[model samples]
Target: MYTSFFLLSSRWSLPMMMSISHRGTGVAMSLGVSLFGLSALVLPGHFADYLDLIRSLSLGPVLIYSAKFALAFPLSFHTWNGIRHLAWDMGKGFKIPQVYQSGVLVLVLTVLSSVGIAAM
Candidate 1:
């Protein structure tokens, strides 16, 4: 019926995947931030209490760092890809080569930025 769509790795190009990911990350972050804010408002204690509960878990350093990276990843990716989209909006980087280059650049920067933020 062709009512559904999928992104097969070999079928979709880099820019196509990045565009899809950008939209997905944007929606995810928006929903996540909204829920977090709502939760904070509805929950009993202050934000520090929530932070204390998590810290008291004593999750090892590796796990803590991994969790930080997981939290940072979407924000990093969306920010870099949003910049790429802005460039596109300006009628720049429309060439196929430039598109691929920017896509790769965005991914690299996302990972690097995420890791850097996570390290802190």
Candidate 2:
């Protein structure tokens, strides 16, 4: 008699991937905010000093826009996922299909919101 206990490793399904991404992004965004808060408290200079420093760099518009997008992307993803969590907390959208659908929707919303914020 032969016995096999090994299980084949396979790629994760969409829902699993989404769930992991959501958690990862949430942790990253929380850390980002915490770091910002800590820096604000520890830094001696005022906010205007930093603002002026950046302004004086003379970087082109494309670089400025890219930086804006980088900053906004995490914020938008966190906001969208937070909404998803809120919906679940209210006992809504618990279905698997809804979860997957909302995952995709959140991503789209994140991209749109990030773009809009970066544009400003």
Best by TM-score: 1
Off by over 4 Å in 1: 1-10
Model 1, 1-120: lDDT tens digits are: 233444333477788888899999999999999999999889998999889999899899999999999999999999999999899999999999999999999999999999999999
- TM-score per candidate: 0.89, 0.78
Give the true-structure RMSD of model 1.
Answer: 2.6
| Model 1 pairs in collision | none
Error of 1 at 78 (Å): 0.6
Q: Once superposed on the true structure, which residue ranges of model 2 sit more than 4 Å away at CA?
A: 1-8
Query: Model 2's lDDT to the true fold?
Result: 0.86
**Least well predicted 10-residue stretch by lDDT in candidate 1:** 1-10
Q: What does candidate 1 score on TM?
A: 0.89
